[model samples]
Target: MNILFVLLPLGLVLLAIAVIAFFWAVGNGQYDDLDSPAWRILLDDESKPPKDPKDSP
Candidate 1:
């Protein structure tokens, strides 16, 4: 039908766009360091309690 002509080209364009995006992401180092973040989050940042005004007596 007439809709096939339009839908087929539209789908092809979308697929081409997705392929370009995937390649671009791979080339830009976006997928790098996937594991480093998990290890970095295990760090501890404990804060000391505030000194009370009466503790200095």
Candidate 2:
């Protein structure tokens, strides 16, 4: 019975911390570009050309 008082407040504090963290992430632009990162992996990087072994000193 005594443990309920301790556990209840601890649980509420944890929940409050989680809610604050979620809002902080949202305000920091964490979820702004969700799709671009996934699509980036599929796109080929053509900016740099492959170097040949003969070109090395």
Candidate 3:
């Protein structure tokens, strides 16, 4: 029974911290481009040429 007092407050504090972090992330535009990152991984990066094995010093 005594543990409930400590556990309850700890749980509430953790929940509050999680909510604050979520709001901070959203305010910082963290979720604005969710799709682009996923699609970007599937695309090939052609800007840089592949390094040649013989070019190593």
Candidate 4:
């Protein structure tokens, strides 16, 4: 029974911290782009090959 007093407040404090962190993340645009990153990973880069040094004038 004595442990309840400690555990209850501890649980509430942890819940409050989690709520604050979630709000902070939303305010900072953390979840603004939902789909672009996934699609970007599927896209390929337009890469160019390096030329040999002997080809230079």
Best by lDDT: 4
Question: Could you give the candidate ranking by lDDT, starting with the highest?
Answer: 4, 2, 3, 1
TM-score of 2: 0.79
For candidate 1, the 10 contiguous residues with the lowest summed lDDT are 48-57
RMSD of each: 4.6, 2.8, 3.2, 3.7
What lDDT is reached at residue 53 by model 2? 68
Candidate 2 wrongly placed segments (more than 4 Å): 50-52, 55-57
Each model's lDDT comes to 0.90, 0.94, 0.92, 0.95
TM-score of 1: 0.65
Q: What is residue 51's positional error in candidate 1, in angstroms? A: 9.4
Model 2 lDDT tens row, 16-55: 9999999999999999999999999999998654498676
- Candidate 1 on 1-57: residue-level lDDT in tens? 999999999999999999999999999998987998888789877966659966654
List runs of model 1 lying over 4 Å from the truth: 39-43, 48-57
Alpha-carbon error at 6 in model 1, in Å?
Answer: 0.3
- lDDT of model 4, residue 20: 100
Candidate 3 local lDDT, 1-57, one digit each (tens): 999999999999999999999999999999998899899999998875549967655
Ranking by TM-score: 4, 3, 2, 1
Task: Tell me model 2's lDDT, rounded to 2 decimals.
Answer: 0.94
Q: Tally clashing residue pairs in candidate 3.
A: 0
